[model samples]
Target chain A: MAAPAILITAFVVIGGMATALAQSLGLFPLVGPPSLTVAAYAAQASDLPVGIGLSLAIAAASTVVACLVGFTAALVIVQGRWCGKLVAALGTLTVPVPHIVGAASVSLLLADSGLLARLFNAGGSWPELVGGPWWIGVVAEYGWKESAFVALVVTGTLATRAVSYDETAALLGAGRLSRLRHVLLPLSLPTLTVSATIIFVYSLGSYEVAWLLGRAYPEPLPVMALRLFNAATLTARPEAAAVAIVTTLLSFGAVAAALAYLRRSTLWR
Target chain B: MIPAVRVEGLSKSFPGTGAPVLDDVNLTVEARSCTALLGPSGAGKSTLLRAISGLERPDAGRVLVGGQDMAGVGPEHRGMAMVQQRPLLFPHLNVLDNVAFAGTVRGVAKRAARADAAGFLELVQLAGFGPRPVAALSGGQAQRVAIARALAARPAVLLLDEPFSALDPELRSVMHDLLAQLRRSVNPTVLMVTHDRSEAAAVAEKIALFSGGRMLQHDSVERMYSRPVSLEASRLMGGANEIPGTVRNGCHHSALGALRLPGDTTWPPGPGILLVRQESIEVGPGNGPGLHATVSGLRVLGPRRLVSVDAAGVLLRAEIPWGRALAAGDTVTLSIPTSALAVVDDPDTAHTFPGAEKRPQITVQGLATLASIDN
Candidate 1:
């Protein structure tokens, strides 16, 4: 049981250190012969400012939105009698619909001349709901997809905490909102933090939605990285590897921060 | 004002669960009175407390706090606070804030809430400890803080769910005394739920015994110990020496010789339980036929010796004073002080002392059947 976890952690540490060192020394077989260079590192760092900015913005926005959805879904499922069916429905749908399937389904549902256009157009020309005639398509895809992910993780966690803490708070004369704010929020922090960060990091690296929805000028980090990785002829491969390394680094950093947060937070205690 | 709480015909059954956890359960907690709800684990004392505090909605019953029906009123509105088995202090808040939570929720200003919370800190003897984090308080100190918090709300009814059972004996007594002081000072119509019979007897103005799912008896603590309504209640209240026999004519006879029974209006006597507490029986100098008993085992429990003996092939256990010395296998005369005979009517529920059917002779038995040992 412990072996796989130990092995996986060893792989992550060894893999991450090697990748970092290689990227530093410019030992890319695809790009060129083994060579140490400060220029490649400098360019990578300068590119990272913008990439990391977009990356952090998406992470923060998605995580906050997801935490709210999760908290709300949990409250409804725990306190409301009818929310069990919703949970059942969400649970059943979550497993079969892979990420690619979800991205495709969402796009199919929301794209112009798609189901949404049919609903709104009524024999009129397709409104600029997709293809970014305005900033509508990017916002629509990001909101819809991340919100679903948030609700999915939060529903289970919130339900358990709501049930556990609600009765106890009730006995102690804590009202619904007060209990949620004090007891539920603190007690469910470890799970909620982990869940939101999971959604946030996944959203940052998620390629399917960004590729299908975002345009070239303001391409999402992952999709832009994919574009950069493929078009590399020979010398640009190291730069591409550098972008991959940055994305991977972002995921690790977010997870590390969340773990640190969980340690300092009282819920686990 | 109809007492702080009056629960009548309070019955409830969950969807799939057939029997009601609380079945026609009735109890009244007078203002300024501390009543301990006593029962075995599934006895529904805690459930009853929840219903009174308006946590669990009772199916076919009414809970009125201070003459106001608490049908739709929330727990906060009812002025009822419960201290659970665990301290359940908020880690985010320092000691003052956690205790002040109830007052703040009741619309008190933050400064006033902290001031009021500080008042209880002194009351629970935690005055110097307010500014510290809640995590720093010890279990016993935290429990007192929880009590102080409950009292800070100035609740009309305070429900305690085995609040001190988690503490050691010394701390439990300290907490108990503190509770007694709180009840006297504030008169908040306290209701405590506990399975400890001794605790119930010690702390409650009245003790209600629950068994299986039904409340067997709810009476004053003295009455509950001295004259429990049923066999199970008596057994729960610690009636250790119960024996099976019959009543013939006017004399009550048993596996032991017949003695006089008392007049009891509760049960119409006919083959009933001869209940006696271990401390009630006095062991004296003998071999002169006080049921012809022989000691089997003896344990010296400071100031009290728990002497296990056998009489007439039936096993009886008694707790005698330190001065009353007897060894294993020693024959001694065990006298059932006439004041201690509590006759319960159902023999199947307990041991039937012979001749308890007609007249009123209470023949005390020795060690009961080993079968009743596990019970």
Candidate 2:
């Protein structure tokens, strides 16, 4: 019974990737006869390096921020008080808001003439957060949104798995900081890694947030791919597929690394 | 010297649970002495231990360690360590690191802490097992490691919350022996909680009895067995026979006829319950100047047989040696010395038995039979 569903999912995922690979290799084209060449990849090689680096930097920044904030939020949520409930409610509220909506809100709220700049009356000295060289707006949007996802997932693991050992550590004379370092971090490492991987991959491949918030000069992989895919030149389509393929490969590499690290963790075992 | 541990009027109740988990409990343990909180499950024994360890805050009263108040002290600062029922060893640490955790957390050098931990492992008979991961341990080995870990802290008070209840019978006995060795070598003031009466009596110099969130009695192990203060306490302490009667003129009058109360008893003239330890009641075939009864049931428990007898409709069970073969329907005379009797009054029936209510003649053989199932 499960075989059919598994097969269908495999076909959809693998078939889509195969089609993209074919297009990137110049074996399939929308406006010309089929042929094979590395022209599409070699054409964007210079831009490809910049795009991959930008995408990696953004995803790395977002994942680190999300994990740290989410881990702290998870600790608070597991404490089980009014404050915990408030944090939990806020996380729950954040998770369902679409990232596109989140990006729009972030752009509006952090732009030079946006809400905070107007409210604070500091329009002239505003930080240039949106459409800035630092890509601060894109990273912040991903961090804020994905932290809630990470928090909820990690809180579930901590509430059930870490509590008993946490108490045991306390009884063993581990103070607050020591308990956090020894018990909470080790116990929650696998969950944290898994959630962080999801956030990283999502940030790497998502285009709408970066496109809406990032400066046009050195775009992230997803934004550059979408731009090329929609350009007037038909030859740009293969370049777009090449960028997408690189993004997918990077995600798969990240997931494989995370799984390798988790497999060696004593707690994960 | 001040007691090593003192709990004064500690009370705790969970929100929305009207019945308190602990109610007006007070207890003390002398320096370097062991005390057991013996009671049924949910009797608040473990809760009291947690309160003393500072893992739990009581709604009323407080805990003192070595005559110092423990209010606002966290478990980490309490100079106390606890071994939970399931041997909750740190999964990320190997056995040596787990046992060395307390010292390492206190800034002891890792090598020094581990060397000290190896000695503790030896004390618990797990010396060579230090390199093994906690997950690789057997149930008994894991518990031994937990005990070693707690002891490596060199705590002022060691709290054990049914630490051996989860192990098999043979492993539990081994743990008990290790505990005895620890008491002799370390001699730390210890407070342990257990529902098994024998476990408490074997490990603790003093035993406190609790039921329904209230402490019923605290006494030495010998006195707790021979002189429980209430019928509830008597049953908890493993006494099987309860003869409902009234006390007047220092004599208890029941279906078995008037009997003299123990000289130490100071109960006033009132309806009372007479409790007799089955081990204290003697049964023989020869006639005697005691209650003449007939055996209604017999059970073999190792080298002893639990003989149930009915003396003029007052049912009683006696533990007798298995030398002479006894069977159901056999006639025997049962004698219980006045020194072996403990009479306690029921609060509701303090004044009367309600319109000349006759003593119920139901056999307590079922109670003895149920008690046997625990073994």
CA deviation > 4 Å runs, candidate 1: A1-57, A79-82, A122-129, A133-161, A232-235, A242-264, B1-3, B15-18, B243-272, B287-302, B308-317, B328-331, B351-375
> Top TM-score: which candidate number?
2
CAPRI docking class of candidate 1? acceptable
Shift of residue B358 alpha carbon in model 2, Å: 16
Off by over 4 Å in 2: B1-3, B245-271, B286-290, B300-303, B347-375
lDDT of 2 by residue, B102-154 (tens): 99999999999999999999999987998888999999999999999999988
Per-residue lDDT for A160-194 in model 2, tens only?
86777888888888999999998898888889999
Q: What is each candidate's DockQ, to 2 decimals?
A: 0.38, 0.73
Q: In model 2 chain B, which range of ten residues has the least summed lDDT?
A: B350-359
**What TM-score does chain B get in every candidate?**
0.87, 0.89
| Top-lDDT candidate index | 2
Model 1 over residues B279-315: C-alpha lDDT tens digits? 8877767655466677888878798888876766666
Question: Following a full C-alpha superposition, what root-mean-square deviation does model 2 have from the true structure?
Answer: 5.1
TM-score quality measure for candidate 2: 0.93
Candidate 2 docking: what grade?
medium
Estimate candidate 2's alpha-carbon lDDT, on a 0 to 1 scale. 0.88
